[model samples]
Target: MGLWATPTLAVLPSEQLKDPALEARARAVSAGLRCVVCQNQSIDDSDAPLAHDLRVLVRERIVAGDTDAQATQYLVDRYGHYVLLKPPFETATWLLWLGPALVLAGGAGGIVLWLRRRPTAVPALAADEEAEVARLLGDNR
Candidate 1:
């Protein structure tokens, strides 16, 4: 352990790729990665420690001759599809992809059924009843 010893510290974006192209690629990949700690923020946008770690890992993989797809798949393999901001529309994510539309369609169908089954409007007062009531309670004689 000399003064030159590389400290076991987390990697930063500036400490990562030398090539701007690779950095751009990492940025693109990071943009699609969800921050597991900050569930609503992408790793590229999040300041969470785990997000920084993930961003560094992505840059490392890209620098180490892995394609963007390969690096992304590596993360996906480790974290499951939950790490992805947009999961594929498959069996696992079908509910997420279609739940809203299905709800809307069901609501529309329910409204149609209700409209069809509605009873016809009844008069507030029938013609004969209106006349009799007016006669009984005459206006100002």
Candidate 2:
């Protein structure tokens, strides 16, 4: 099998944490960041150049004594809410989160209205036709 090629992280080697806890924190931070080149993938899973750079940035932040929330806020501040998979509940995002349920409710209401307006099936034929059938059967008894 051919050797797997790892993408080069852009930060200097001195920026990397020597301690295991900091390394874990760095990994956690990296996993939250979306790869700009691959919008659907987080930095941890993407091999794109931007993702490599983001991985390095995450490590750098951790080494610089930034907490996970602080590092995430730093990225979010730069990139805007589009980078987040789960955006916060705010006026701008309320429609994005609740639009589907509202649409479903509207559809259900339309169906109910249509059912109420539809005509009922009416029974056809006259009294003479009913008598003929009774004669054919000898009598109603």
TM-score of each model, in listed order:
0.61, 0.58
lDDT tens digits by residue: candidate 2, 1-141: 222354444333554578979877887777677777889877867767777777778878877888998888888998987766567789999998899999999999999999989887767768998788778888554
Positional deviation of residue 44's Cα in model 1 after best superposition, in angstroms = 0.8
Native-to-model Cα distance after best TM-score fit, residue 16 in candidate 1, in Å: 4.9
Evaluate candidate 1 by giving its C-alpha RMSD to the native, one decimal: 7.9
For model 1 the local lDDT of residue 105 reads 99
Where does candidate 1 stray beyond 4 Å?
A: 1-13, 103-141
- How do the residues 1-141 of candidate 1 rate in per-residue lDDT, one tens digit apiece? 533474433345365578879888988898888899988888887778888889988988998899999999999999998988988799878998999999999999999999989886875998999898999989944
lDDT of each: 0.84, 0.77
CA error at residue 7 for candidate 1, angstroms: 28
Global CA lDDT of candidate 1, please? 0.84
Output the TM-score of candidate 1.
0.61
